[model samples]
Target chain A: MTAQPRIVEVRQKVLRRNDVLAGELRDRFREAGVYVVSLVSSPGSGKTAFLEKILTMMGRQARIAALVGDLATDNDAVRLARAGVPVRQIVTGTVCHLDAVMVQSALEGWKLAELDYLFIENVGNLVCPSSYDLGENLRVVLMSVTEGEDKPLKYPTIFNGADIAVVTKIDIAAAVEFDWNAARANIQAVRPEMEIFRVSARSGEGLTEWLASVESRRAAKNRPG
Target chain B: MHELSIALSILEGAAEEVERQGGGRVYAIHLKLGSLSGVAKDALIFSYKLASEGTPFEESRLVIDEVPVVVFCPECRAERRLSSIQQFCCAVCGTPTPDVVRGRELEIAGLEMDV
Candidate 1:
């Protein structure tokens, strides 16, 4: 008699474990009243620069701390710590993105309640970072003027997943001849009704509005539910 | 690429399924690959081979079912398959669709095994 092959139905999500952990982290963040924000962008999108500026601007008032992810170096961690806020580096080694477990582990020995705002700077990749949820209340995706206007269209998944979009390097937007209308149109096309913030880390323009918006949103999230 | 990590997760998931099935050797794994899942099919197949090494799945095959992106348009009140990833607007009314009804799947559909 011939041996028969068995077919077993699995129907399981591949990243379900990460999703569960991220849910737990979200609960923990909510209970502790610590608002978490994460940043995602392609490399050289001025994410670190903008984060540095934000930390410098709101660190004292918000009691903010940060955790930055990269493929190899602690360079971002080092640079962000210079703003005098507690910063940790999650070195992903060969991984292209940061998962919930990595974030939970990197936050070892730290009290989430003690920190009002915790920022997670994901590995600088627009594609992979969108797939993993790191339990952040606000997920901000960045695009620099130098990266072209159609970036949001090219990576719609990332844009669709983000709560807010930030346009960086606006100080040189005129010098680069960045098309404001085209950029806004493209972002709107991919994600209609998306809130976008334009800022320049060098001149610090638009930082106050961004900070105020973040503060208001965080307050909204902290409302008794 | 993150495909390797995804491949690892698939293997882990498949192994658990295999164990729950009262012990069997997995011959092939079936997966649903979606357009909006942000996973490359060819890259995932290649990574699966590398990740399966030295494990029971070393000789197993990965069979992926490619799923097309499907979005629902509230204006049109219809769900349509996306012809292009760049164009998310409804095929009927041309209104942009923010509701994705399908094509974000990244899951192990089933397993072919010998009991």
Candidate 2:
């Protein structure tokens, strides 16, 4: 008789290692009382511009640091450092998304407890970044007015994965004929009750409310039980 | 693409599982892939070939089961599977649902091996 092959049951999540590392990173962030926020979006969605605004505004109230990831170049890092905060660039080389290990390695010489807010700017991509969690307390997904309003519906995975959504380039919304109500409705349809913020980094229209909200959330997270 | 990284992870996991089984040659790896997992099946398959080269999984075949998006409907009080990812509402009651019951899976379910 011919030999029979065996079938073995091995139920294991493929990303288990990353998940475990992310859990450790989360615990570390919690212990240090550092509020980590990450930004994700498609290219040219003004993530860097918005982050620059946030760093400038919130830096006055807290000690902030930024780590930006890109396939190549430290352009974003240099630009963000102009805000006069500690900034580092994690050049991912060929990696499309940033994983927990990358974030952990990028934070090698830094002390988490010395900072209030740590911002991670993920490589600009809506699809791949949704699958990787970088151990951030707040994950912000952004879309610019220049992109389609149905962007949320098109990439619902990212929208669902994010804690908040930010609509960037609002100052040029009128000029671009961006449909404001449609965008809001699309976001609502995808995530039901997701918190959304509209801001113009150029004109600083909605910076106050956004900054105040971040401060309050950071404060609340650090509050004793 | 990120599929290469995913394929590499799969190879590592599969190798460990095979080794844990007290030595075997893997013939096929069965995977459960959900559309919401953000992985392109064709790309992953292509990348798997590159990732498995010169490894124990070099000759293994990837058998994928595509899982459709399923969500819990509060209005219907039941879980419904959607025909398409674009339809986020309950297939039965048609109410919008953010409570996903199933999908978003990326796991190796089983392996066919020669002992």
Candidate 3:
């Protein structure tokens, strides 16, 4: 005789392991006094350029490091090393995104307390990265002028998950006819009141303001509740 | 694209739950997938089938309950169901609010098993 199948109650998160690990990472970052920032975007959105600019500009005053995620190559890490800070490349192989476990393992020998700022450049895919949290104080989603104004609307999930939106390659905005107002509107439509930064990493436009905003945000993170 | 990974995680979670229940053959898995969870339901279903091969859940059915995005509208002082995931505003008062109260759930609600 076959027994009847019964319904079992199991209210559990599928990503609970990742969430727990991320929570631990968040606590560790807090104790170590390092401001962690993560960048996410579709491929060729100028994330590497923007991050390289930030690292190069802030390297003099801050103890900085970066963990860059890519499918196969260390090319980005090689390029970013020009800034002269400690940089590590996380080769994800077939994986599309970086989870907390990857980030934890990547920081094996590094001392988080010695660093003032740590940047994680996620794999250049908007969809998968939105599902995982890397314990970062800020998650910046970048969209280049060449990607069109409707990028946010098309990938609303990633934009909605991010804390800030950055418009990259503004120096060539006119060549691409990128509608700033339309892009901002689309982003606001999805995220509502999200802080945005317009930047040109090549020409150094808006770098000062962006840097100031980041510093202030980091300072605010250090404030005790 | 990462649905395969998500499918594997679901299998892992279900297996643990089954083990905790003294071992059972799961026939169905109930999942709550949110609009903002960044996972597509159809892709996940397909991936689940591929991931479940040779496992106890090989023949299991994944029943997904898609949860719509809901945000807290401060202007109306109420939780409102968003009409569209693209626009995060109160359906009633049209107040724009970033305070999302629900709709990011990717959880296993229940499992049907033969113990």
Candidate 4:
């Protein structure tokens, strides 16, 4: 004779642990007066280049640091360090995404209060990174001109997860005949009213507006509630 | 790729639940996965099997209920089911709204076990 299995209600979020950690991180950032931003996108979308540009430009006006994640190499950290801002590399080994635990551990020794802005560059992956929240004030998703306008349509989950969409490598938009309007339309189709920024890290096009917008956002985040 | 991690999380949640109930042999784990949760159902099921191997849940079954994305339609003044994630508009009114009311759920709803 075998006993029948009984159903037991256990309504719980699977990622509750991550969510709790992220909530703690958010409170920590708020107390430290640091505006945290995270970047996510597919590989070869110019995340490092754009981050490098932001760090170099923003370094002059405010205190900023970055934590870059990759599957194997610290190459991105080395590249970003040239911008003169504190950069840390999180080698995920075979992991494809950065979770809240990784961010919490990486910030173990850093003084969050000393920095005005903290950027987390997630591993170059659109799919996996969308699931984990890194406790960022803003999440930016990059899509290069070479990656096609349909990129957002193909990966709506990531686009929906992100707060803003950045079109990188606009300098070669003409060379690739990338339809800017179509890209914008596609992004809007997936995530309505999503703020979009067109920038070229190589040519420095559209950097001024983007930087100003980011600075204002940071200011707003630091404003007393 | 991240499905393996998600499977592990499910296992951890189930184990905690079993312990809370004074320990039991888990027969099945019920999960509610939303379309916009960014976790593929098939991949998670496959990963669950591998993650359960050699564990107490080795013979346990994973039951997933896939939930579709739903958005609040301002024009319709009601919640509407979205036909496709690619389009955020209401299925009936076609009003574009960013107010997502549902989906994005990765949760353990229940468990069947014998204590």
Candidate 5:
């Protein structure tokens, strides 16, 4: 009896192509001098609220644009546009995450050269968004004070990919008895050196510092080497 | 919840692969899904059946190799597979936070088909 011949040595990455496209898009964003930032958080974590306030504060100085994704509805974009910033809505029919392809599609008619800051608010899904890259310079993961502090531990992948963490709705922290210390501890446990901002979009607290940080980062990127 | 979409993508990719490698019916698909991938194996299995309906992979079975989360213990200077993402620390030495060495993968290894 002849032994059956077996062939091996097929090394393939299913998502390697997507990662390549994401790298290309990152290069495009950098070359255009656009500070691309993406936001990821759970449902109703006040992403829109925080973004609206930030956009309003960043008017004139920065030509800011936003792309908000949801499972349905253009409500977030509509709400965000009232702040006098160019905001677009991406309705991902049945998708759970915003991948690189979606970001590429979202920038179809967008003039990247005209914008200083471009914020892409991913679909409100902690689990799905972490697996996909949207070609952003920074991925900001937001966690509201009302949510359990253990969210960082529950969704460590999201936290780990994030460049910074924004603790939203801090004004109501005491009302909800939110463990700010535990929240900080959880985030620090997962990402030791991640920059964190405790901001209240409603009360306008910590807005200056957050705005300053954004400006500093953008300025540092534009520095002559 | 997004398992159906992932399953559909898997079937679509596998079908294309099989068609490119001559005409053959897919028998099975091997997947490596880590514990920290945020994808439930059972959910993907349940969705695979629905997604494969009327597709080239209609009769294929999904065999998943679940990988545990592995972390590097700075204290012990060793890598260990973690039981859970919540407790991603050293098994011994009571280390608080360690770097995640592995286990956040969700990939389709390959497809098996009758040539």
Candidate 6:
């Protein structure tokens, strides 16, 4: 037998499989004209409440749906479904974060082609979610003002992974002694070019601008190059 | 934690590679972990053992290379290795770097085997 070095210079990424699946999902989302917005944040950072408001607000303009992920409990799904949109709960069964496989499975049996907007609420953790690609067109990482300004510094990876950083609960920023400027600076320190959105899901402050940003991005992608 | 999910993916990737190679059991998986990979090595070590249970990768060793985060100082036009992952400031110039030339990766770069 000829000696052929079985060692192949693959140069393939470790998450190559997930990347492939995510690409396919992206194509599916593009073809269906569905704009997917994924939310990720640490526990109790108001990710659920934020999505609830989003679903409630966007309920008038278009058809919307959501998939919520958690290690346990279907509470968020219940809350979001109150907006009169179809919501699916993905109980991760002990996994700390949702991966591409979980996202792909959640898409099954659903007519993605029919939906206008799809939102995925990730498990309440910053670290793990950063590593997984959940096939989303937009990944919005939320940080409530109640959290520390050093949040982006400590959890740099999660902040860096996000396309946009949403500072939530601005209504209580001062009451909670939250330093808004420092938080923005901290995020910029970690990811210099990341978009910033100061939103109060409860007060509806900054929601219109946030929604407009999402719409413009969707419109931009739909535009021919 | 998320380490379990990452460990699962690592095992799956290694298994697929091993199967395609005809015959060999994975003895160990080598991962080049950059300082900015966001993975705490100690935590991954603990999670890897737990994730490998009842799977083809059971009993396989995990070898990790601690790669230092290196960046190019745009101001000074010099490449420097970060003293720590948390410390992104250039050592010599003390300038904030614009691009991440190396570091911040979660990759299964290589694998050891028994054919």
Where does candidate 2 stray beyond 4 Å? none
Q: Global lDDT of each model?
A: 0.91, 0.89, 0.94, 0.94, 0.82, 0.82
After superposition, which runs of candidate 4 have C-alpha atoms over 4 Å from their true positions? none
DockQ of each: 0.73, 0.71, 0.89, 0.87, 0.30, 0.32
lDDT of 1 by residue, A1-225 (tens): 857888788899999999999999999998888999999999999999999999999977888889999999999999999999999999998888999999999999999899899999999998898779899999999999999999998898888788899999999999889998999888877776778999999999988999899999998977778
Interface RMSD of each: 1.4, 1.5, 0.9, 0.9, 3.7, 3.8
lDDT of 6 by residue, B74-114 (tens): 88887888664444667787776646778866777777665
CAPRI-wise, candidate 5 is: acceptable
Better of 2 and 4 by lDDT: 4
Query: Per-candidate TM vs. native?
Result: 0.96, 0.95, 0.98, 0.98, 0.89, 0.88
List the candidates ranked by lDDT, beginning with the highest.
4, 3, 1, 2, 6, 5
Candidate 5 residues lying further than 4 Å off, grouped into runs, are A1-11, A219-225, B74-77, B92-98
Model 6 residue pairs with clashes = none
Candidate 3: stretches off by over 4 Å: none
Q: Is the docking of candidate 1 incorrect, acceptable, medium or high quality?
A: medium
What pairs collide in candidate 4?
Answer: none
Q: Of 2 and 5, which scores higher on lDDT?
A: 2
Candidate 5 lDDT at A10 equals 22
TM-score (C-alpha, index-matched) for candidate 5? 0.89
A47-113 per-residue lDDT for model 3 (tens digits): 9999899999999999999999999999999999999999999999999999999999999999999
Query: Which residue pairs overlap in candidate 2's backbone?
Result: none
lDDT tens digits, residues A139-182, model 6?
99999998889899898778866889999999998899998888
RMSD in Å for all candidates: 1.5, 1.6, 0.9, 0.9, 2.7, 3.4
Model 3: lDDT of residue A162:
94
lDDT of 4 by residue, B12-78 (tens): 9999999999998989999999999999999999999999999999999999998999999999999
TM-score, candidate 2, first chain: 0.96
TM-score of 1: 0.96
